[model samples]
Target: MSRDHQASSQHDGTAGDVVVLSQGDHTLVILYGDVDVRVSEELEHAGRFSIDAARRTVMDVRHVTMMDSVGVSFVVRLAAGLRSAGTELELQGPSRRVAELITLVGAGELARWLPELPLEADVSAEQA
Candidate 1:
């Protein structure tokens, strides 16, 4: 992704912890929530919104607890779109499960781009 494209996204109103969307000088993040079939939709919605707003975008999924095909496709296609436009697309915030899924799917083994989850997030640590 472009060095200038940096953003963090937080998704609200879900069983998982709040997902974050923070914009850097030039990056977009698509955080992953708890296990859900609708994850793909959520991820795509966030990404399109960011692109529509005319911001350089990157997708972060390092925090994802579990990812299925839907979630996978959303990110893969999103990255393709950015590449076509010469824009940088980053996928960050992947959980351990997500990391394994990436390999299982053979999605180019994108290990270098994964980012760390927020220190405050409680993926499985149980919330108060």
Candidate 2:
């Protein structure tokens, strides 16, 4: 049987993100902007909410402008946490500079997890 349902969204009215859960073989989480300590809590909630439910999770970071070490730390920790539960986490779409920060922190090992994606406003289709 095929099942189709409308997706729901909750906005925090900050520079957080438009989280979308593409429920199929894998899940994709698209982040729109700065992911620093300020928005970590919300981002984590959205990311974990998706990753925890799927076998593979793709984190789309194409639109990320500024990502502090705190953000990086949270993401690395999230990856580690997900691994413990037998789930895979993938980070994608970081600008070259942002990617450098992630690499400088020695979290580059997670580089392979970043997926290549078209640069665009994915928010429009997030609910799909």
Candidate 3:
């Protein structure tokens, strides 16, 4: 079974949303747009939900247009939290820029990188 939790924000009609989808022992966090300080709160909330729901969490970063220090912190912190709980974090479909920044910050070791997105069929099935 799967469940979804979503948080969205819009500033001056520009921003993105955080959507959490949990399936079995895996949870997928979908993030879009500028993932800077603006979405930190939503990201944190999603992180908490991920920890509470799954043993493995995957953050979907393919739709992110930009990232700032706060975004990096969120990933690092979330990874730490999950680690303490004996869970794991994975970065799914991160763009080159996002990947670079995370590596530059030395947070790359906190998570494993996946070049592909979660299965569309699974998402669609959950939606139905």
Candidate with more favorable, higher lDDT: 2 or 3: 3
lDDT of 3 by residue, 31-118 (tens): 7888888788898899888887647998988878788898889899989989988989999888899999999999999999886755
Prediction RMSDs, each to the true structure? 6.5, 5.6, 4.6
lDDT of each: 0.54, 0.65, 0.83
Point out where model 3 deviates above 4 Å: 1-3, 9-14, 117-128
Candidate 1 achieves a global lDDT of 0.54
Off by over 4 Å in 2: 1-14, 121-128
By TM-score, who's the top model here? 3
Q: Deviation in angstroms for 16 in model 3?
A: 2.5
lDDT of 2 by residue, 42-123 (tens): 6667656665664676677777777887678866876676677677677786789878888888776753555566554565
Off by over 4 Å in 1: 1-22, 53-56, 109-118, 121-128
- Residue 128 of model 1 has an lDDT of 50
Model 3 scores worst on lDDT over the 10 consecutive residues at: 8-17
- Looking at model 3, residue 5 earns an lDDT score of 77
